[model samples]
Target chain A: MRNEFHADLQTVSQLLVELAQEVRAAMRQATRALLTADRRAAEAVIAGDRDIDHRYRDVEERVCELLARQAPVASDLRAMITALHVAADLERMGDLADHVAKTALRRHPSPAVPAELRPVFTDMAGVADRMAEKIATVLASPDAELAAELDRDDDAMDELHKGLFGVVLGADWPYGVETAIDATLLGRFYERFADHAVNAGEHVVYLITGHPTPS
Target chain B: MRNEFHADLQTVSQLLVELAQEVRAAMRQATRALLTADRRAAEAVIAGDRDIDHRYRDVEERVCELLARQAPVASDLRAMITALHVAADLERMGDLADHVAKTALRRHPSPAVPAELRPVFTDMAGVADRMAEKIATVLASPDAELAAELDRDDDAMDELHKGLFGVVLGADWPYGVETAIDATLLGRFYERFADHAVNAGEHVVYLITGHPTPS
Candidate 1:
């Protein structure tokens, strides 16, 4: 029975890694849709979110069940709790990706990002993608060191996010208010994507060290 | 032993209500600061968020401890799970309020919501404040009916949020890109506050019925 519980726990951990991978893809696709105004890609990201959510719910149910039936103590208990928190962060990351996709769809036919601002978004998306990749890797390995690296990546994302505002709010900005609003919100989406990645990293760090890195 | 476990469970539940109340006050004070351009109010709201976070962590530790020590099953287990989820939502709500306060401070001495668009923000804050209040009441009483009503309030918030965009994007709008950006982000802060409240309400509904609500 104890062996079976460990196997189930391992399955739960595997699902978390898979969930992270899905969120990474969803956000990347959403960024593609945003940059190129590809309706199909946007639709795909929006649609794929349901699958991510399904997997997230699967994690939740398994974790709750393990806590109840296994009555896991100490590190095992922390693992169950961390699985739930990590799954939730992954699920929310998927939603943020969906939000980005929906924004792309809202401005269909014309790119939501202007030509000049596209590179900034491309950079932001690049950082976000790398962060998501690292998130999956850390969740799979529970490496405290890699998780710490994601924080530096988050700082880079924040720098890009701030630069985005500088460009949009620049005195000579050529875009109208509508584009400004879109830029503002889009920047928020990517910034928050990175923030959630950092949050997931924090959870993984806690799982490994049993000492939560201060928020 | 069973009775003692429940007493601890009750303490956790009571903390959830207090959390909801703190969130309500935080958002309300944040709204006041935005409307009045009161730097002190904004600072207070920002500083108060730490207290909210501290309480949130307290709830988290107590729930995790109860789960480890008591190994509650059935409704007791559901209650523990719900408490964690609800506390998280409340904490996020508090953060949203902090965002609103910071927005106000960034525009200090000059109101974040222009005089013309102030009414919409007023209405949004009113809806969010009421939702927070209702969240506290529902958590305290575990009333599915009241919890369900928070969804209606969320819809109201969405409408206000939409109307805000319409006004900002209107051709007659006189504000510059910066104000529009501020309005867009502010609208989002309130909208997400309401979203988190609905999330907490769903958690409560699940706790009461033992049947998960469709997300």
Candidate 2:
């Protein structure tokens, strides 16, 4: 029975990793849709979110079943609980990507991001994609050091988010209120996406070290 | 042993209700600070959030301990899981209020909501307060009907959120970029706060009826 419990725990961990990978892909495609005005890509990301949601529910139910059947304690209990939290973070990340995609769809045929701000958003997207990839790695390996590194990656995203504010708030701003609103919302979506990745990474660190990471 | 487990579950529920009340008060004070530029109120809300976080952690640990020790199944398991989800939503609501308070703090003595948009924001705050109060009631009683009413209340908030977009996107928008950014972000914080309240309500409904509510 102990061996079976351990095997179930391993399966739950693998499922969470798989969910993280799907979320990473969703963010990548959503970013592409936002930057390039690709309606098809945006639609794909929005549609793909249901699959991520389904996977999240599956992993959650599995974890609950494991807890009920095995009643894991100490480190084993922590692992099960952490899996639930990580899955939630990944699901929220997927939703953020969907928000980005919806923005792309709303402004279809005309990119949501203006050309002048494209470079900044491109950089933001790059940072977010890297953060998501690192989250997947941390979930799979559970390395405290590597998980800590993801926080530094998130700092870069924050800088980019602030840079966006500078552009919008500058005296030279030429975009109308509509564009300003779009830019503000889009920047927030990316910043929040990176934040959730950092959260998932921190959970990984906690699961490994049994100590909480600073938010 | 069964009686002890049930008693622990009751304690956890009470803790969540208490957290909900605290979150409601935080939102009310934060909104006041934003509209009136009350620095002291803003500071108080910001400082008060730590207590909310502590309560959230307390509730989370209690639920985790209950699950590990009791191994609750069926309705009992669902109630425990719902409590975890509800506590998370409450914690997030507190953070949203904190965000609003920080926005107020950053623009001290210079109210974040412009005079022209004050009425709209005032209305938004009213809806948010109502929603929060209703969430507390639903948490205490777990009535599916009351929980369903929270969704209609959220509809009011959505209208206000869209009204904000209309004002910002209109040709008559006179505010500069900075104010526009502040308004947009503030509007989003309020909308999201209400959304989380609705989520907590839905979780209550789920807890009572064993059926998922529409997202």
Candidate 3:
């Protein structure tokens, strides 16, 4: 019975890693859609979110089943609980990516981001993609050191987000209200995506070290 | 042993209700601060969030402890797991309210909503406060009927959120880029607050009826 429980725990970890991979693809595609005005890509990201949600519910049910059957204690209990949170964060990241896709869809044909601000968004998309990849890596291994590194990586995204504000509120601002709203919301989507990745990393760190990292 | 487990479950329920009440107060004060630009009220709301987080962690730890020790199954297991999700939603609502308060602080001595949009924000604040109060009531009783009503109540906030987009994106928008960005973010904060309230309501509905509401 103990071996069986450990096997189930391993399955849970594998499921989370798979979900992380899906989230990374969605985010990458969503960023590409946003930057290039690819309607098909945007639609695909929006449609793909259903799959992520399904995976999230699956992970959740499995966690509950494990708790009910094995009644895991101590570190084992924490692992199961942390899995629930990590899945939730990944699901939320998927949703944020979908939001970005919807923005692209809404402004179809004409890109939502202005040409001048394109570089900032491009940089943001790159950072967000890297963060998602790192999230997947850390989830698979649950390394405390690697998890802390994810937090530091997220700081770059935050700086990029702040720089967006400077461009929008600067004296030379040329975009109209509509574009301003779009840029602000778009920046937020990427920033929040990174934030959730950091959150998942913190959960991983907690699972490994038993020390909860403050968001 | 069964009686003791049931008693612990009751304590979990009571703790959740108490946390819901605190969330309601924080949201209410935060709204008031945003509309009135009350720095003191905003500061109070910001400071008060730590307490909410503490309560949330307390509830979570207790639930984990119960699951590990009692190995609750069937309805009992479902209730404890649902409690975790509901507490998380309440904590997020508190964070949204804090975001609103920070917006007020950022624009201190001057309201975040322009004079023309004040009435709209006033209506939103009123609706959000009412929703929080209803959430507390439904959580205390776990009534599926009351839980369903919260969704309809949220429709009004959604309408308000849509109306904000129309106002901001309208050709007659006289606000500058900074103000437009502020208005957009502020509108989203309120909309998301109501959305989280609805999510909490859905959790209550599930707890009572065992039917998961579509998120």
Top candidate on lDDT is 1
For model 3, residues B36-80, the per-residue Cα lDDT tens digits are 889999999999999999999999999999988898988898898
The clash count for each model shown is 0, 0, 0
- For all predictions, the C-alpha RMSD in Å is 1.0, 1.0, 1.2
Off by over 4 Å in 3: none
**Could you tell me which residue pairs clash in candidate 1?**
none
**Candidate 1 local distance difference test against the native:** 0.93
Clashes of 3: 0
Which scores greater on lDDT, model 1 or model 3?
1
lDDT of 2 by residue, A105-166 (tens): 99999999988899999999999889888888877777899889888988899999999998
* Model 2 docking tier (incorrect/acceptable/medium/high): medium
Residue-wise C-alpha lDDT for candidate 2, range B182-209, written one tens digit per residue: 8999999999999898888888888898
Error of 2 at B91 (Å): 0.3
What's the iRMSD of model 2?
Answer: 1.2
lDDT of 1 at B114: 90
